[model samples]
Every structure is written in C-alpha cells, then in structure tokens.
Target: MNGFAATLASQLTSALPATAPLIKAALRADPGLLNNCVSLTRQLERLVYEPFQAIMKGDLLKETISKGPFDIVIDGLDECEDKQGVEEFIDHLLDFFQEHPRIPLRIFIASQVEQHICERLEDDRVQLCNLDSHSPYDDIKKFLQVSFCTAAKRDRVIRAYIQEHGEWPMKPDMDMLTEQTGGSFLLASTIFKYTIQPATAEDPTTPMDRLPFALRMNGR
Candidate 1:
C-alpha cells in the first residue's frame, strides 16, 4: 500500500498540471483548487470525493434522485506513499467542506494519525474515533461465530465435530475465546481457523478445549 502511494505520488507530481482541469470538470461539486496542480488530487478524488459523492447520492441508480446527502468512510490514509500529497489532499478537502457548509457529505477516515493529516482535519465538524478505546471482544466473538459457522457447515470434520459435541462453540467457549483475544479481531480469527483445522486435531472429545490452547499458541 505504501509503495503504491509513493508511485501514485510520483505520477501525480508529473501529471497534475495537465490533469487538474480534467479533474475539476469531473468533480464540479467539489470546492477546491481547480487550477492549482497537486500530486494527490487524483488519489483524493478517487478515495475521498468519489466515495463521498457515492454515499451522499446513495446507489448509482441516478434516475431516483439528482443529488444525494450522505457520508463516506476512508480507511488506511497513512498507507499512501506521498506524505506531502496526503497533507494537501486533506487541506483542500477541509477547505471545500468549509466553503460549502451544507453539502450533505461527511467523510470518515481511519489511519495512524499523522501530524500533517491531523492538523488539517482537526475541525469542529470532524469527529475522531480512537480505535484503541473500543471494546472489540464482543465484535470479534460475533465475527468468529459467524465465520466458523459458515466454514463448519462446509467442512466435514468441523460439521461432524459439531454434531458429536452438541454444537462445537457454546456460549461459555465463546466467552473464554473472546477474553483470550483481548479485542483483536485478526488474532481471534487466526486462532479460530487453526483450532478448527484437521491438522490441529488431537482426538479430543470436545472442540472447546482446543480453542484455549490454539489461541495461546497463536499469541492471542
């Protein structure tokens, strides 16, 4: 992702002057520099403006409404290769929103807060969510249950185990697994997959016992 961002930034630095007018014509609703060339304009348009427009307008069925009022979500902003470009993008975006106070479009971005990006977006209208503050245990547990249930139905071993064990993952096991995960969805998922795999089997009477050991082994 970082490499892609860098490559994109390099391309933008070379092509921005020629492409700025085209971009402005394409995003007429967006309020920013129509003449000023910038490296991140294209990336910002695709990741930010386009998604914002889509969300505000709802689906692509343009026949229903001429315009839409909606919010957009952008994740992994820091992954972009161009640091200065990212800053400029945020600056123009904030400026646009400031100019058009009621465009019915909101943007949500998730990333490791960088200084330039943070400075540009720190406004009264913007809402910041700290992912570290959330309790992800319940969410991870729910995701694991749903994912495993789907996988179990297809895999003969898992399906047979569930039948023999009277449901492989009961409420109690879920609680334990959730606690062990410490609210990391990736950790929980990796552990769950390993536990259910045939190679990890130990001929145990219950699948519940394997969960704790598997999670521990995976450093969950």
Candidate 2:
C-alpha cells in the first residue's frame, strides 16, 4: 500500500506540477513520511490528500475547478499479494472520500470482483460497473486487426504470408478468432502474442502457421 501511495504521489506530481510546492510543504511537515516505514494513510495524507485539499480550498480554487474533476485510476488491485493491506487500503480510501465529500476528485478502481475489495467498495459513495455485462467483441476485433497490421510491418514471416495469401487472417479467420476469445481481453492479448512471436529451434512454427493453432486453442 505504501508503494502504491508513493506511485500515486509521483503521478499526482507529474500530472499537476503546480501542486508540487504544496505537496512538498506537506512532506516537509513530517520528514521521512514518504518512506516505507510510514503507514499508507499517512503518506496519502501528507503527499496526496492534504495537498489536494489545500489546492481545492486555496486561492487558486476557481482556476483549478475551471479545469476540474480529475481522476485517479487504480488498476489490478486484486493482484496485490497482501490481502490485509488491500483491505486496509480500501478502508482508508473510502474514509477519505467520506470525510471530504466535496473534493473534486474521483478514483476509478478496476479489478476482478474479489470479496475483500467488493465488501469495502460497495458503499453508496462508489458507483460500480460490471464489465461482463458489456460485450468486448468489437474492441477485441479492433485490437487483433491493429496488432496484425503492426506485426506484418515488422515480422518477415507475416509480411511474406500477407504478400502471398492476400490478408494473413481474412474476415472469416478474424471473426473466428474474435469469437474464440469470448469477450476476454486477456485471451485476445495472449493469442495475439502466441500467433506473432518469433519461432525458435524447439518451436520453429512460423506466425503464418500459428494463427490456425491459436484459433484452435479457443478460450483454453
């Protein structure tokens, strides 16, 4: 959590350079507060929340609000190894928003529906969206198209196949591959890499040969 807090502080500094002075002032108030020894909540208060609050309440409030409503994206929170830390971090996050409801900031966390995360973030303050309800077929199709095009440019095997075979993976192949992924971004990316990765001595199959194989794997 402290590592996450430090990264957030760095990103905040980069995104809003004008707030650096205030953030630095907060850090100065408590020396070594950015270090790992400090609690995540304390690092957040001194480095992020306090500076953010100061800016929102300061003389330049109108100017900031004019540019208003910033977002902080926290992705793959469920992948964190420390379960207790994750729970504590979520608690701290919700408490911050609850205490300062007027702050013009929004945190968007994208993670699988793990019980610990869901239990904390199911608050009225947070709006939830289930990605499974929405089909990602079109997005996956576009990704495969762009990925194949880019690979064809850099990969001699794909280039040769495209030159000989007209489009390496035609509309029918694309539709099949897209369907095989079943709206999964991970599967889409995995198969893309599997298809285009350079062949080795042990696995000397060319990318031209791998497309059919990838399609065969389906969602496995």
Per-residue C-alpha lDDT of model 1 across residues 1-220, encoded as one tens digit per residue: 2233234333433533333444445546544323334345554555344443443333432522455444345679877777776777677777777776766656678999788678877788677778889887768888888977987887787788778867767777677777777677777877777677654355643344466676454334
Clashing pairs in 2: none
Instruction: For each candidate in the order shown, give its overall lDDT on alpha carbons.
Output: 0.62, 0.85
Off by over 4 Å in 1: 1-39, 42-73, 79-81, 98-106, 200-209, 215-220
TM-score, every prediction: 0.62, 0.68
lDDT of candidate 2? 0.85
As a TM-score, model 1 comes out at: 0.62
Residue 160 displacement (Å), model 2: 7.7
Model 1 CA lDDT for position 16: 31
